[model samples]
Each structure stands twice: as C-alpha cells, then as structure tokens.
Target: MHPRLKAVSFAVATLLAGAASAQSATHIAVTDAPDAQSATADAPASTALSRVTVQGARVRELPISSGALGARTDLETPFSTRQVTAEDLDARQVKSLGKIFANDASVMSLGDTFSFNAYSINVRGIPLDDYNGYKINGLPFFMTTVELPVESFESVQLLKGSSGFMYGFGAPGGIINFVTKKPTDKTLFSADLGYRSDGVFSEHIDAGGRVGDDRRFGYRLNLTHEQGDTYNGANVQRNSGSLGLDARLTSALTWTADAIYQSRRVKGGVQDFFLDDFNGDTLPKAPSGRKNLGAAYDNTFFNSNVFFVSSGLRWQIDPNWSAKVDVSRSQDRRRYSGQWMGLLNGAGDYTVYLNKAQGAATYEQAQALVEGEFTAAGLRHQVTLGLAWQGLNKQTVPKSLYTPIGQENLYAPITPLSWNGSYDDSLQYHNYHSAQKAVFASDTVQFSEQWSALLGLRYSDYDQTSFNTAGTVTNQYHKTPVTPTVALMFRARPDTLLYASYVESLEQGSTVGQTYVNKDEVLAPLKSRQYEIGAKHEGRDWGATAALFEIDRGAEYANAQNVYVSNGQIRLRGAELNGYWNLPAGLRLTGSAAWTAGKYRETDAELVGHRLEGIPKWQGSIGASQKIPGVEGLSANAELHYYARFDADSANKYKLPGYSTVNLGVSYETQIAAHPVTLRAGVDNVFNRNYWGFLQSGYTFVGAPRTLGVNAKIEL
Candidate 1:
C-alpha cells in the first residue's frame, strides 16, 4: 500500500478503537429532539440524535452566513438562498454537486462528475468565479477543479445574486458555503457500507463525542474510502479523512479547529468533445453514454489531492454582544493526462490530441468580526463590523504539451495513434498571485413592528499579478472599489415577509485560453448590479417563496476573429417559485419552477439581441415522498426534472434539444441486535435516456445512463 494510505488506515483504526473503548466504559444520554420550528436553535445536538434515513415531518430551518453581515435565516435575509442538510444527503446518497442540486431550478451543471476531473455549476445563467465563488465556514478557499467530500459537512448553503457588500469580490451568479460538522454533546458512532452498479463499493465511518474531565473538550472524526469500476468503463479510487476539535476554556469563551484531507484518482476517464470548427446548423446525434471511444492502452488518468485547516475563537461579551476571529489555509494539487477531440466537419469525423499538465494552488485567509444589538433614538438597531484579508498563489508547468495523435469517427469508432508523454514536476513555476483586503459594516434598523431597513457598505483593495515561464511579471492590476447594498422589508404577518433589495458587486477578470488569439492575457475587472423583489411565507406544515430579479453584467467572450476580449453588456431577467407541503396521510410534495430571459444588450451590433448560450428558457422539478401506512419505518420518493431547448453558441446558429429524467429511491429502518440499522436503494435516469448534459466553451458532454446504488448503515 502507498505510504499515505497506510498512515490513514492506521489513524482510522486508532480513532475507532478509542471511541469503542470509551463507549464501553461510560454511558452518555442522548438529548431530546428539538421541534422543527426550533431546528436552527440547537442544531448540533438535535440533528445528531435524529433519524436521517427518511424525510422528516417538516423542513428544518437552517441558518446561513452572509459573510460580514453575520448569520440569518431565509425569512430574515433579503436574498434568494437554499440549504441542503445532512439528512438530505444521506437520504439521496448524493456523491457529487451535480446530483445534490439535480432538482434545483436555479442551478445547472457545467460539467459531469464522471467525465471531468472536478465538477462545476452555474446560477442564473452566469458561471461562478473559481477563486471567489466558494467558502468554507464563511472563509475564502480555492475551488477551481476541486470537489469536497460531502460526508464531512453539516450542510451546504447557496446564496443567489450579487453580494458585493456581504463578500468583498465574487461572481454575481452566487456563493456556495460548506458548513463543517462539529463535536456533538453526546457520544455518537456510525458506520456505512455501500455499493453501486458496475462494481463500485465504499465504506465510511463517523464518530463524535465530548472527552476530557467535565466534558470540556470535544472531537469529531470522519473517514471514507471508495474504489471500483464506474458505469462508463472508468476506474476510480478515493480516500478522505477529517477531524474537528473544540475546547471550552470558560463559560463565555470557546476555541475550535478543523482539518480535512482527500486524495482521488481516475483511470480511463471520458474525454470532452469540442465543436469549434463545425459548421452544422444543428447538433449531431449523441452516442450511447456507455460506449468507450478510447483505446485500451490509452494512457489517460486524473489525480487530485487537497488539504485544509482552520482555527477560530468565539467570545460572548455580555448577552447582546459577541465577537469572532478565524484563520485558515488550504492547498490543492492536481495532475492529469487526457485527450480532447475536436470536430473537423459536419460529419462525425474528429481529430484527437494529447494534453498533459500539473499544477498547485495555495490560499490563506484571516478575518475578525463583532456584532451587537442596541436601542438608540427610540429605534432598535443590529450592527455588524468586520475586516478580512485573503491571498492566493498558483504554480503551473512552464509549458503544457498539446500534440495531435490521430483521427477517428464518432459514429464508427476506431483506435487512434498513441503518443508517449508524461508530466514533470521539476518544470513547475509560479504563474499567478492575487490578494484582497476589505473592511465592511452593516446596520439593520427596526423602525416599527412591521417595518425595517438595512444598509451596508464595503471598501476593498484588490491586486493581481501574472508571471511568465521565466518568472518575470507580464501583467499586473490594482483597484480600490466601494460596494453597497440597500433593502426595505415589511412584515405583513408573523409568518410572512415582503421585501425589495438592490446590490452591486465586482468580479475578477477572465483569462484567455490557449485556443484564443489573446491567450494568457487577463482582462480588467468587471462590475455587476442586481435588483430583486421577493416574498416569503412560513406556515406550520407548508412554506413557499417567490422572487423576481434582473441583473446587468459586463460580458467577455471570443469575438468573430477568435480573439477573446471584454466588450458590451449582458442582461438577464428571471422569476422563480418554490414551495413545499407536508400533507396528511404521510405524503409530502415539493416543487420549483424558473423562467429566464437572457440577451446581449449592447456592444457588437451583430450579436445584439442574441440569446445566451447554454442557458435554457425554462426549467423545473417536482418531487413526492410517501410513507407506507401498513409498515413502519418504510418510505419511498420519486422526482422528475425538465428543461427547455437552449442555444448552443453565441451566434445562435445551433441548438441543443432539451430532455427529462427521473429518479426513484426507497429506504427501510429496523433494529438489529439492539442497534438501529437502515437500508436504502435507488435508481437514477430510470428511462435510460441519452442526451447532452452540459455545454461550455463550445464543448459538449454526454449524460450518464441508468445507474443503481444500495447501502446499509448501522449506528451504535
């Protein structure tokens, strides 16, 4: 076994042994379950003790962080957001972001999990910035071609639209924050064994408890491993480990730390197809997803490793005031060798080439914040003040190798010529660096019982530099911008809220790719603005939200000359509705629908009024869950997703057909040897549909076919 694997295995065994010994020596009482209404109040204890194999009676309220603005519930915040809990992850057996948001109308996958080294997604017809789009515990992290292990997180939260005041600099599309699981008040241990069709198997272990005298010290640990052949003739192996620790030094002071590591490798992975040279007016027929077009000796693989650590302290100064400070560091390393096929004509003929590269990215961040509530001038006010600093450094090979191998037909497959090439770590050099510093403040004033207003502002200093192969700076940029946000909210009733909000944000410029004439050139920063109006209602057994939004953002794309440049403006207007009902007779129903109209507003006359590429006009999903009346602890669920046809390119000369898919799952819970056990089975793409999953940068990926998964879990 590899040295790292051996060490991980030993650590997992040691932790499990220690937990088992502790369990046998002492008895820890589990806390009472909190009602759904108070789900966000005592989340750690309540969620840890609750059953997660089946859907709960109501949607649990989850708190989301608004960067420097602090934490707020959906009904309290003036933004569109969604939260996926740990229970949802377990019940669906989701392993990737694509599957996690499959039923979300506002999110669309940009890459597939099985074919790409890492998955990517877009919101509101705009792609997320790799550097600024993601966060861990509200701290910035690198997310380009990186996938985190879902098993280690307590919940995944999504914030939609421009957030310049909330976060320093980011994509206008949205922000995704991953919340880590913390130590539990009671002793807990669980293990799971799982299998997927095509010979994939996995094992996972989770443990948490309070240790030390007086139970002042706490710890949480998770370990996972999976290895096997995939449904598309590829082999994958993954291993991960995570640890969280906390110490309560006093009644009002607490210190916490977290560390996570993961390594994944894939062999014979599917390659993406490019259609830049194709002149056809319509997309060609898609091939079966199960077919492997590459040769058996195709030397292709992807390897990735990630490590992260963070430490923080929370201080409660009296009852109405609090303070927090945190620091974090993260590193991502990747190596890959693959072939990309480029279409040469209207027919299925294509040319193949080899691409090889290795790179690494390191990020560091520090932040401090204070929040307080006070009454002044006969008005109540909640205030927040914070400061943050973050930096990123990237290393890449001096030069990537791209050589043509041979030719092949998509319909009639044939083995192409192979070239011998490998990546050399010794040739790596520093390629890019960026830094940001910002101070922000926000005030929410309650003028009356039914009226309130919010005002926020952030001043950010941003700098970036790009280096050539010889370690000499080629380009540098510096900017100081002030972003602001304003909102007005009215409480119609205790359970309903109506609000209007406006926000502005600044985004990092795009980098030109090798295929463009201006390769390696970095454009100037782009500014975006958003306006939205929304309403939210939270009932005893039902809830719903509706919103209308419009955004104007700077546009950058390859021009007719194939030179990438920033010019013109892009406008997008949309409306969305989402609701859930926990009805009688053990039945629950949830649905969502979205309508978007995207167009090129100004700039090039020929491109004006053109529809945005890869964004559908309409998308929606409906889901149903039912519990068996005769048998206890048994439940079933089904969901269906639909999409409308969309443009395939900016010129609007080609179009890709839309398709629908269905997923079904069933779960059963029982007791075995006085221990609680749960079994689950699921099937995806029940109709075995074959269609284009996603399109980006003139490249298309084939969707996955029918697949089955089964798992059994036991808690002690």
Candidate 2:
C-alpha cells in the first residue's frame, strides 16, 4: 500500500463508523438505558448533560449543556475552549492523541517520539506541560515516559487561555483536560471493529450497566486489541483494558472505582519521520533528503497499569444550598527497555547509540475536597475549596545491547538481535523521583442578575532528586508558588453576552525548568497572564461570537537556540477572531484566524522583533458541511489551515518562511443492521505542496499524506 493511502484509510474508516453509530442507536437497547454512555441528550427533557465524571464526583449535572462559548463550542467565548465529543471521535476513528488535534489551530504538535517522548502540545503558544499536571481520575498517568494511547479518553477538552485557578498551576497559553469515560449507571454495550491503511486492525468491546438488577450498583469494562504498521512501516501492536464501577449508597451518597491495564509490543522509532512543514502548506511533503522512518529497536517496553478508587456524597443540606465531599487515590506503574539506533553519518553505514536501557516509573496522587453551590440575590454561586497532593518515582538500568562505532563489534540493520548476548553490562542508574503538593480554592460569585465574577488562589510546594548508580548523588531542589486570578461576565441580552477576564497561572520549574550548574539559575516557575473579552449571540439555527485576547509568558528553556539568553522571558500578544454561519441554502461555514505580535524581552540576546520560535504569526482554518438532496447520506467537506510568516529561531537571526495547506474529504454512509456504515476518501495536501512547519537539526515530523478508508459501527 502507498504510504499516503495508509493515512487515508484511517480517515475514511473514522467517518463511516461515526455515521453508523449515530443512526443505529435509536432502535437498540441503547436509548433504553439512561445514564449509560452519555446517551443522546436530545431527548428534550432538559437541555442538560445527563452525567459527568468530574473531580471524583459522578453526578448528573446540567450546568454545561447551555451553549458553546458558555456551553458549546463558542468561538468568541473568552478563554477559547474546544471539545472533541465522544460521538465525533467515534465517527473519526481517531487513534493517536495527536490525530485528534490535527485540524485544530489552537493546538500545535511538537511532532514525534524521541525515546517514545510523546508529541508536545502547545496551548496559547506555550508547552502544555505548564498547564494542568496530566491526570486520570486523580492519578498521574504521565508518570511513565511512554506513549499513552489516546483511546482511553472518551472526549478531549483543550481550553485555551487562563484556567490556572482550577488546577493551581498552568500555562497562560491554556490547558488540555481529558475526561475519561466512566461506567454507565444504566445498561449498555458497544463493540467496534476497524482496519486502516497502515495495515492496522483493531477490535474493541466496551460494556457497562447496573452490577445487579437493583440498579444501585453499576460497572463498566473496556478492552482493545490491535496490530499494524504506522506511516513509517514499523510494526505496531498493543492490548489494553480498563474496568470501572459506581454505586449509589443513598440518595446523597456514592462510591466509584476504576482500573486500567495494558501490555504493548512496539517498534520504538527505528527512524521517526517528519514533514518539513505543517502550518503553511495545505499540500504536504517529506522534508528534503530524509531517510524514511524506521523502527530498529531489538527491545520492548510494557506500559503496564493504572488504577484508582474513590467515594463521595452530595448532601442537600437545605433547599437553598448543598455540600459535596469526595476523596480518591491512584497509581501508575510501567517498565520498558529498548536499544536506540541512529542515522548514518555522511557515510552509508548505520550507527548504534545506547546498547540497551531499562526504565520504570510509578506515579501516585491523592485528593480530598469539599464544594458548595447556592442561590443568592436572584443569582447562583458555586465554589470549591480543597487540598491536593501528588508523588512520582523513576529508575533505570543500563545493559549493552549494541556496539558503538568505536566499540570492537558493529551493529547491523538486519532483523532485531540480542546484540547484548553474553555481554556484561553494569546497572548504572539509580535515580529516585520527585513529589509535589498544593492547597487551592476557587469561587464563582454572581454579583448581579446580569453578571458574575470569579476569583481563585493556590499555594504549592514541590521537590525532586536525581542520581546515577555511581557513588555520587545530586542534591534536590524545591519550588513554591502563590497564584491568583479574576474574571467577569455580563449578559448583553437573552441571546447575547460579554465576558472579560484577567487570569493568572503558574508552573513549577521542573520538567525542563531546572539548570544543574546554578541552583539560583534554576528557572522560577514560568508565569502566564491573560486578558480576554468576547461576545456570544444565537437565534434559530444561527450563532456567532468574536473575541479579542492577549497573553504574556516568561520563557524557561532553550528551544535549541545557539545562544544562552535565548531562554529569556518571552511574550505572545494577539487577537483570535472566529465564527461560523449556518445559512439557509444548505451551507454551513466556520473558520477562525489569529494574529500574534511576540518577542523575547530578557537580556541583550540576538533576537528582537522576531515572532516567538516555532509559532506562526497568523493561523486560522475554515471548514464547511453541506447538505445534498440527490445523494443519500453523502456529504462533502473541506478545511484549510493558513499560517503566516514566523521566525524559525529566537534571535531574529534565522527565519523559516510561512506556508498554507488544504484538506478535503467526502463521505457516503448509510445504516446497516441499524448501525451506520460509511465510506470516505480525501487528499490531505491537495496539491502535494512541499514546506516545513519548523526546523530543528533539520528533522521534521511530517504531515500525514493522502489516505482513504471504510468503517462500520453498531450500538446497543
């Protein structure tokens, strides 16, 4: 199969699967079970979501069902938030986390896995790690340095701008909050079978319902099995499962527990590939003169287990107010090892890097909190006060798997080999991990019938240690931060509203926040501040919003600029304008574009007037969904991503030119056995435009090529 066709296969499979699931559920036992898999809320009882698995509390709440900016995907809404609903994900057949954000302008991918390093996501032009600490039902899923499968999440929420108050510390750019699917309170079953152009085949079974006939006890289970080659042809496979249970002890009390386990066999990037560009070129191409991606590892890593348990109760103290309390604990354990291979120097011979390295990590978290909501002065107010704690541990051992260029023996590019056969290699690493703790409180106050105000603050303390197996050990460091934020919302009319906010967030300098030579030189946690105002209006089938926002950031690490001062404080100030018009002539159009003026304000560095590195000065996208009368279940849609000129490096010294690209997909889906069956095909880079999104050591994570696929899904 052609490389591009493999990607196209996945795309087609996704759209068809979605159309099937949406149409087939009506007659199945699906709708019969309420609170079972967030059934279509279109039932018309109350325009509220049926349930929410939030902060250890599993309660059916209607607060978020309102609209996009306020509830739905409001483009002009301050804060700029977006959600990939479970329903849409089903139709799209999105497998990797990166795939979900492919078309989104607000989220940028840092590209491939180096040592299985996950693709980096920049929210508001800042690394995502600075926002919410990666969490899963209150546990640290990110503890293991492995590529976590994105399927574990039913929906992914990317919130742009300031939300630091909710998580204590975060980036001014925003945060990515993934809401995992929970056990259904009612009864349900979902099975999915799929195949993509990448030679990947998969099977999944997700089932849930009341544990017994009483309906007070319920449990859910998910299982996935898959194997195939990715865009680079490295064979890929994984087996994973998760179990969940929720029980209602009394009208006001509840308890829920969940666990996930998986063992994966993967070909760590024999050769990770990249495209020269992603933002500017609608057409795509492999950067010039690059070896096709390959997986040369003779080793394997099993990303093993993650589990959590918790109990909570919502007590209606009185008609005017209510109190809720919940506590949960979770743990993540993983072990992996692999030999790393390197590209050949100017000569044609291949190179061997690390012979073999074995690594393991355990991440744990605990949370206990009390929250309250009440009606006051013809308005409503909600607040949460709590204490949160997190811990992490990591260790690794060295084993000789391959001979280096200077070694006596040479490593070959043939099949995977136990190159370490009989070689005596010492365990050379013994670094214990780090820990973090924080106490925070946030409140939403309705100041008047037409407006509300929000205020929040959090204080945190963190510490870490790193050591090699040798007799020597490194000292540890600590960080403490106090952050505060405020915002206001005013109702312009029943169909229109305006919001303005000044929100602040902080990130403890840790991941890349440390400098070994100078303890004082260690970065202060990065600071992010934002100001935003936007309006929302809607009537009949039409809705629109326009927002203007600005954000500032303090840089922490070098994106690899040759200069030291390159890590100085940087700022991104811009306005994001977006909207969608659903007209009467069978046409629905939507797109958003933004402009940013940025620079490094620190020392006398070589960079000034240059836009921030790796960021496009202007980026926006437009897509359309059309209705056709002649073709049954057929729809054609296209979207374009445009990025203006940008600086390739910090010191205005080097710059990479900007580019643009367009993507088109058409689908024809119809119901089968009550489940929708769909066929889709499209060309990603319509003209095969050649460009580079950014350059680092001349390596690029290539944009996907043209691909096609077909998929079927059934629901009951």
Which numbered prediction scores highest in TM-score against the true structure? 1
User: Per-residue lDDT tens digits of candidate 2, residues 563-623?
Assistant: 1222456677665544445455455565656666666666344443446676777777666
Residue 271 local lDDT, model 1: 66
TM-score of each: 0.91, 0.76
> On residues 167-230, what C-alpha lDDT tens digit does candidate 1 reach at each position?
8889899998877777887787888888886777888888888889788888888888888887
Off by over 4 Å in 1: 1-62, 414-416, 420-425
Predicted model with the maximum lDDT:
1
Number of residue pairs clashing in candidate 1, backbone atoms closer than 3 angstroms, sequence gap of 3 or more or interchain: 0
- Report each candidate's C-alpha RMSD, comma-separated, in the order given: 10.9, 10.4
